[model samples]
Target: MNIPSDLKYTKSHEWIRVEGNVGTAGITDFAQQELGDIVFVEAPAQGSAVAAGAPMGSVESVKAVSEINAPASGTVSAVNADLTDHPELLNADPYGKGWILKITFANTGELSGLMDAAAYAAYVAESAH
Candidate 1:
């Protein structure tokens, strides 16, 4: 499980990297591993409003289809168009080029509700057992 220490995580398996009021989000390494061989991504459009914990889009894999949730409330500023062509990037590098959405969040305070890397790791471990 390549859980980066700098990102915040949701129980649903989304991770967010906050920079000022902007956040970039994607499914964690654990999620991609479980989903298996991502084939398609339905990304939210730019300027779309998404609420924290709400489904913004979906990812299709050889194993299953999984909803991608918003980790914070915000207007989506960008979507990774690259995923449309190369969904494998998600499994290959989820934290970097595989980011699904960039959001300009309304309240940075909402981030405190998300789990830090340590807590998320524990959560994943606990869920596994």
Candidate 2:
């Protein structure tokens, strides 16, 4: 529910913090809450080339397993190595220390389809009902 105004969102519940052509991606706080206690994460390899809407990795929670999709087309520039040792970071600090991926731009046009924070909040609210 802590959707920061500066970020954009994907329908799959991932948040993208764009900084020029590079971006930081993470699961939204609302997403982690719904998924429950996270136990493990499958992160993309460093330098992996990923496409928009592709399955970059997956997360395992106490309740179920969920795939984490790319918010936009890009190459995976970095992976948060800490998650392999502490997947609970997704629940504890989803927006900060728990960021899932750092990607370099491949398609700027894909960004037009992403939702702003306000729009995404409304989208989640409607879907929750």
Best by TM-score: 1
In order, candidate lDDTs are 0.95, 0.93
lDDT of 2: 0.93
Give the alpha carbon lDDT tens digit for every residue of 47-99 in model 2: 88888788989999998999999998888888999999999999999999999
lDDT of 1 by residue, 63-107 (tens): 789998899998999999899899999999999999999999988
Off-target runs (Cα >4 Å) in candidate 2 are: none
- lDDT for 67 (candidate 1): 94
Q: List the lowest-lDDT window of 10 residues for candidate 2.
A: 47-56
